[model samples]
Target: MQDYSEKVQVIHNEKFGRHLVAQLDIEAGDTLVEERPLLVAPHWECGQMKCAKCLQESYVMCRSCKMFPLCMDCQGHDDFECQFFASGGPGGYICKDLLVKNYGVCALMKFLLLLEDPSTRKDCERLLETPINLDDYRDGDGMWQEHEELAVRPLMASGLLMSLTQAQSLTADDLHAYCIRIDSYSFEVTARDGDTLKGVFVCGSLPHHCVPNTVVALDEEFNLKLYAAVDLKSGEVIYNSYTNPLMGTSQRQHQLRLTRRLECSCSRCLDPTECGTNMSSVKCRECPDGYALCELSSGGDWRCSKCSAILPAADVHELLAELGGALVEAKGELQAFESLLAQYKTLLHPNHFLMLDIKQNIASILRATALMNCMDQPSKKLLARRVELCSELLPICRAVVPGISKLYAIALFEYLLSLIELVELQFSEGELNKKEYATHLKTGRLVAKEAMDLLRFEPENSSEGYLVERLAMELERIESDIAKYGR
Candidate 1:
């Protein structure tokens, strides 16, 4: 096995076949690994015009082929006769044109192209030859059987194999084995332009967890950096959440089986209340208080911990569907959003997924208002309320997503901006005391700095990148004002 770094080592076990474990004590926010993507593709169904090579916005097409879009720098590179292009001098063939429109086909094509390199091809073959324990994916459980017949068989027959290999052919069994490799080790690549693509990282061999201890960040070039979400002890297993961190336990498990093709027995998945976050809980109709805790078992009832109020599984699903519809229609309308919030206030816990959805929607409105520079009475009130809402959400975000996650970073930026504006508004009206103003200024500086710390890893031209620059300028202006004025 190829060693990624001194901080982590590869290990194999019966439950999770191959995973990474910490070698030394690591601090929170410490970088554990940095791996480049083995393959990258345009965002799935992304209709935006982009450079085929660099993935940046480009209007320039290859003059000879008129088929492939190229950024100026990539077009100017002298190695036009490289492996990516056909042998012709100027009108060389573009290899990527073989796969387009579909993200899965495109990504797979890129992976095959990567294997054309002798060194990478050898590494991939060796990695696939290593045996993995499949006791978790047995035939009797309906997991392995369904996956083989449905997913694996269809992919092998899809003609992607014949196209990429350039005349080389592989059997269904060969493709099936490769599918296992891809599903087990692939990373979801997020580009600098906010496009999401499936990527295979050269050193992305991490274990699975419903609540991961580490988080991954990527740059414009798709180079990945892993950061410790919490302080790590030596020899502890490092885990990555393959699914969204905010997903309820049951929802996460279902999604995981479809993607990772394994049943999760992680600590959070086994817990009824998801480690006391109550993310999957719903308020009992019979009981005035106490939430009905959901279980993974089909026969298991959402039994109220406090009372004997039983919620039928079907009813919970119905409520969730209704909540999704309401949230979708509540966009950009404060009254509709507030009504839904009021309705769900009693139907779900404060930290439940529904409530979080409403809070996030409200935050979006506040962000728009802040950007509009609207300081009318109602807008100022909204801004103050937003500051409180964000303050509440930030601690919860830190508790669950304890690293430099994009959501946490964005929330921090919005919160700092709101605070900065609120303080300025108060000062303009001469209603701010010097001490209080200074405190707000100091808090803004600290939060903005933290947000920037995370945003520095993002692409410069991306939305996060623009936010970082704006926040930095605001922070600098705040400091200058503080220096010029007393207190």
Candidate 2:
């Protein structure tokens, strides 16, 4: 096994399989692990044409295969899969349209090719594999059938995979097991252009947490880096969230169950209020002041905190679905979002996941409008509302996402911008004197600095890293304005 990090040690257990534990006290922002992927390929749902070798957007097709897309640079590098495609395997070459739609075939081909090396095969065998029942697919049986047609059958029919399987004493079942392992362990890496790549890392797959103590980032070249999101003591387990942190407890649990096939009993998962953020709570319809909280389980019933009213699990689920559908239909429209928020304010907890979603959309719309330099009364009110929304979100983000995270950093950055704009507007209309303006500028500088600190660990080429660069320029501008006002 690769020694990916000296600060952490891999530990195995009956429950977690393989997990990482800290060896020494680690501070927030500390680099925990860094490793290049053992295997990298286009994500299963990747529809955009990309060079099979470099994963960059490309229209240039390989002359040899005439089916696989390759960049001009990669055309000269003919590998095993490339040659097999050119040879038109036992069942003939897979059509380009089929390859494009089922990108997992390409990814699976890479995995099969890697297994040709005995050492690599042995290394991969050590990774965890979850059992997959094609009949029990969450999407439906059709998805599994489609996978069989688009990904599995094509690869099995390939002459390269067949020869390798026979030579290596591998069977079709082993191929299916390898596919299961890839599905279970592969990390989705966002490329520079925002497309995703699936990467299987050896040590990187070990850590697991619902509210992760570690943040993972990938650079332009897809090199993975793990950083401590919070301080950790020696012997403490390192955790990385497999799902989005912003999701509510039930939503997170459902996603984990669907993807990883396990129920999380993590601290955050067990908390009905989700660490006191009330992200999953709703207002009790039967009581004036009560909010209903529930267990994280899908079938858990909700109980009112204030009035002790009981709400059936079915009812709660139906309400959530209705609100979710409405929110989705609202899309990006400011008026629709405001209307939805108004309609739900009395029925949902202020920090409910759906409520937050609506607020976030409202804030985004207002921010875009503010950026257009609108200074009318209604526009100013909307900008103020945006600032208020960010303020509400930042505290919740701090409670849920905690120390250095992209969500918290983004909320803080947006809050900082809104505050600066609102303050500037107030000062320009003579709502504040020079001293107050300077003070507000200094405050804005602090907020900008905090945002920078949080985003420091982001990859230099990623979107969050771009925010850091923009924040630096904004900081300089803030300082300049502050000096001018002070003079």
Top model by lDDT, which number?
2
lDDT of 1: 0.68
TM-score for each of the candidates = 0.79, 0.88
Q: Which candidate comes out best when scored by TM-score?
A: 2
Alpha-carbon RMSD, each predicted model: 5.4, 3.3
- Encode model 2's per-residue lDDT on 376-397: one tens digit a residue: 8787788789889999998888
CA lDDT of each prediction against the hidden true structure: 0.68, 0.77
After superposing candidate 2, which stretches have Cα over 4 Å from the reference?
1-3, 63-68, 73-104, 128-146, 166-176, 295-299, 371-377
| Candidate 1 lDDT over residue span 194-263, tens digit each | 6665566646657688778887766666677777777899999988888876777767888888656758
Candidate 1 collision pairs:
none
In model 2, how large is the Cα lDDT of residue 232? 92
Between which residue pairs do clashes occur in model 2?
none
lDDT of 1 at 247: 72
